[model samples]
Target: MIGKLGATTVAILLSGSVMAAAAERVEVFSTSGCGCCIGWIRHLEEAGFEVTNENLAMADLYAKKTGAGLKPGQTSCHTGFVGGYVVEGHVPATQVKRLLAEKPDAVGITVPDMPAGSPGMGESDEPYEVLLVARDGSTSVFARYPLAEDASR
Candidate 1:
């Protein structure tokens, strides 16, 4: 009985470790000179993601985004991959977590061009949308953030 319990506990622990490791693994492709990109990375780190930063030309990143099925309007400054999904632009870490958790049927998510107040841009004067890029290349708003009337609100 003791041996069986030990084996089950070990299995549970291993599964938990695997899930944690998978959650932390994120590969980011961006330019070395982009401060906002770094800021976004920091946001991910704060949200418990382990980042693997790769220095690539802007063109390369764009190519990867396009290759990953991101349309022109459905792209941002940086590109990331985790759990077989492409993460584009300055998408919030919470959204990213939700993406992993929900495992939606689509290409992945994008914040389009770097939007203000979207995790790394500080404050946004206008609303922004996080788009869900479908496998067929159609995009729809997955998440919308409305700017507060007070500007700082």
Candidate 2:
């Protein structure tokens, strides 16, 4: 009985460690002066993602480094990287998880133009779409969210 109990305990511990390692933390890059960016980081943290915020001036350069082609009117207050994907603007945490799980061919997700009801934007509840931006400066509809509704659903 003692040996069996010890084996069970070891199995449980190993499973817990594996679960923790599966959800890797995310890193976010945003300008120091942007308040909404901070809010977005908080949203990710609340969703169980470990977030690292880097405040820098050359956001355009950062975007380029992450394979996010800087396009006119596509830039936002912040950008993030997770599981080898670039997350731009107020992308919902659930969408980030989906990107990691689905492992699409594209670069990552984006929510252009601080739209209302996004993760950080403190505007009225309005519908928005998260675009899947590819490395070749192409984008397509990835996900859409309704007004005042959470993207996780």
Candidate 3:
């Protein structure tokens, strides 16, 4: 019984660690000079994401976004890819995790036009929306920020 219990405990611990590592990997593309993008990357890292980033020219970055199926209105300064989904803009890390958990059948999510008080955009009383962009370029509100509980953050 003791040996069986020990084996089960080890299996559980290893599975948790492996899953966390695999689930948190994200790849980002942005301009090297974009400070806000850097901050956003930091935000993901703080949320336990394993981030790998590449800097591109603005034109190249835009191309990358387009290639990722992000339309003009859905664009942001930086773009990220994780778990077969695209992430655009200053979207909160929590929302990203939620997206992964829900596994929506959409192209990805975006926070259009870097809103203040977003994950890396500093604090603000202004509210913002995270849009879930569909494969055909339609968007719907995926999440909203500055919730009553989040005001303290």
Candidate 4:
């Protein structure tokens, strides 16, 4: 129970908001034309994250992503930063919170390509994986969603 709210009917409430307030705000970099990127932004907002967006050209965006030490296959529709970690693709806010909480040694987390069932990606009922790209460029499964097993490259 948070903010005088009961557990009952909590489904209609924004639990993410409670979690969001203490969470790190995110800085996003993406092309303004990508609808999925916008959706991802909305997802963050709904999760109670204070997100600042920067629209950059594809070349510039790619430059930033790579400059941040991101590797190939870890690329996604967009990039974001929270705390000291980079967030790539339509990563779930829950995972972001987990990442921040764990404070892992990594460049960031990525959902790979625009998997149909990913956060911003449209409905595909496909499974996907969120990969935590370590600082050394090695990768590991950070989190798994039954319907989210195919996203991370």
| lDDT agreement with native, every candidate | 0.83, 0.78, 0.89, 0.82
Which portions of model 3 miss their true places by more than 4 Å? Answer: 5-16, 151-153
Give one digit per residue, the lDDT tens place, for model 4 in 57-140: 999999988988888888997999888789999888788888988898889898888877677776666778889999898889
TM-scores for the candidates? 0.86, 0.77, 0.88, 0.79
- Residue 80, candidate 3: C-alpha displacement in angstroms: 0.5
Candidate whose lDDT is highest = 3
- Winner on lDDT between 3 and 4 is 3
Clashing pairs in 2: none
lDDT of 3 by residue, 1-153 (tens): 548779889889889989867977999999888889988999999888999999999999999899989988898899999988999999988889989989999999999989998977887878889999999999999888777865432
Error of 4 at 13 (Å): 26
**Considering TM-score, which of the candidate structures 2 and 3 is the better prediction for this target?**
3
- Residues 18-109, candidate 1: write the lDDT tens digits: 98788658999998888988988998998889999898877887788888888888877889998788999888887788788899999999
Residue range 15-84, candidate 2, lDDT tens digits: 9878765555888887777888888988888888988988877845465645555466556778787877
Give the Å shift of residue 131 in candidate 3.
0.4
Model 1, residue 54: C-alpha shift (Å): 0.6
How many clashes does each candidate structure show, in the order listed?
0, 0, 0, 8
Clashing pairs in 4: 127-147, 127-148, 127-149, 127-150, 128-148, 128-149, 128-150, 128-151
- Candidates ranked, most accurate by TM-score first: 3, 1, 4, 2
Q: Specify the highest-TM-score model's number.
A: 3
